[model samples]
Target: MIYQKQECNGALYQMCLYSMGTMPGMSPRQRAGRRRTTEKAKQEINRRQRKWRLMQLINANFVSGRDLFVCLTYAPEASRARALEKFHAKMKKAYAKIGLTYKYIAVTEEHDMDGEPVRLHHHLILSGAHGVQLAEVVRDCWASGLADVRTLREGADFFEDTAIYLLKEDCHKGKGARRYSTSRNLTPPAEPVRLRLGEEEEAEVPPGVKIIEHVQNANEFGRYEVMVGRIYNQAAFSAWWAAQRRKAAPDPWERLRRRRQRKV
Candidate 1:
């Protein structure tokens, strides 16, 4: 009887340690390692969310033929922020003079030239009806150093190429400021339609859209390829979110017990 009681005490002690994440099989170091892994996972989630938001914003406003890509440089005497502000003001005035409206997305970057101080520049995607004259207008309006403008090439994937270029290694680094900005007038992308599928039913592609590729995995979300790019499984995501909310819901009995304890 004493031996059995001791065994029961040992089991209870081990259960307590397990609940505190300090069981014999899991050392403090292992718990700390798990924490590091969780932090990495959180960072990855934040990174992916940022990328998705940027892609969505770009996809909404980008137009192949109507938009112009521009690079602007300024004199060394001017600050980066001041140069950008002045350039924007000048461009707005110039467009107003021409009786046209414009929208733009811009990315700023700084480069340290060989044996020279760091220089600031901008890459801009401007939307307007202006053609080749856009470059001339930018050059004239800039009045600082130089402005190079070109139209997006025909048959090119505007979102893919532009997003990749804008979010390149140098631009994506944590630089204490936003890497890119867009005009407030720019529109957002439409939310993708979610369709639930049965075990036997296959996902159908619309008439005009073409399938590029499909991806499925246990770790990451499954997505179907159609038209422009991969579309994530929104139905699955919605279901998952609903389940999480249900799990996180407050227990009525627990709440009542808490109230009773408070009254005592």
Candidate 2:
């Protein structure tokens, strides 16, 4: 009879996560005690928060094959901000010319794909449409440096690792530099739906929903479960549903029609 809350990010292969026995969040007292948190601890917290927020935007809006992860690298620059500003002007025009409306999370970087803060660059996750020429367009727009475009990878991590890798320059930031920037268009995950569910009920799967991942954990507080699933398109779902309904409640008219055929 115990009920728990379930959360789903509206991705193609959905991300469903929930935990039981955990308090909603840290208490006020816990927050006040954090005054002693070291600078290193604060940076780690910032990095994790940055990654989590980016992942939400990614899972909700971007898909693996349809979107891209792009890297824009530049020669040594006196002003990193100015270099990025100039690049954005051309990049936006290029995307518009190709009939694309893009959403991006831009992470400013200082690493040389290897060590601490040698080069200046930006990493982006861009929305692609209509089989657009992603790499060519970006390469054309960014003359100062390289534009490497890659398809977003798909796996059990669900782009969590991707976010972390793209934000890898966190440890190399100078003083108060930003961790990342996101375009306004990316979607946030849907609000959670709470259900009172039990073992017998959990065994049932909906007609057209495919469960991709499910995990269950237990403790003195109770059993916690997470389920990730994909909702098939309407046509496929409706066809499956109609077949199930026909089997559950057969049409008597079919029998009569068969009898008439036999008489003929």
Identify the leading candidate in terms of TM-score.
1
lDDT of each: 0.52, 0.60
- lDDT for predicted candidate 2 compared with the true structure: 0.60
Residues 106-223 of candidate 1 have per-residue lDDT tens digits of: 8876643232334667888887683536778888878678788888543433254566666654333664657688888878654322232332334333222223433221112111
Query: Ten consecutive residues with minimal summed lDDT in candidate 2?
Result: 13-22
Residue 183 shift from truth in candidate 2, angstroms: 1.3
lDDT of 2 at 2: 37
What would the per-residue lDDT of candidate 2 be over residues 121-230, giving only the tens digit for each residue?
67888777646667787677677777888887765455877877876776676668777777766677655444444423442344556877565544333343445456
- Candidate 2 regions off by >4 Å? 1-7, 11-49, 77-81, 112-115, 171-177, 191-264
Listed in order, each prediction's TM-score against the native is 0.56, 0.54
Colliding pairs, model 1: none
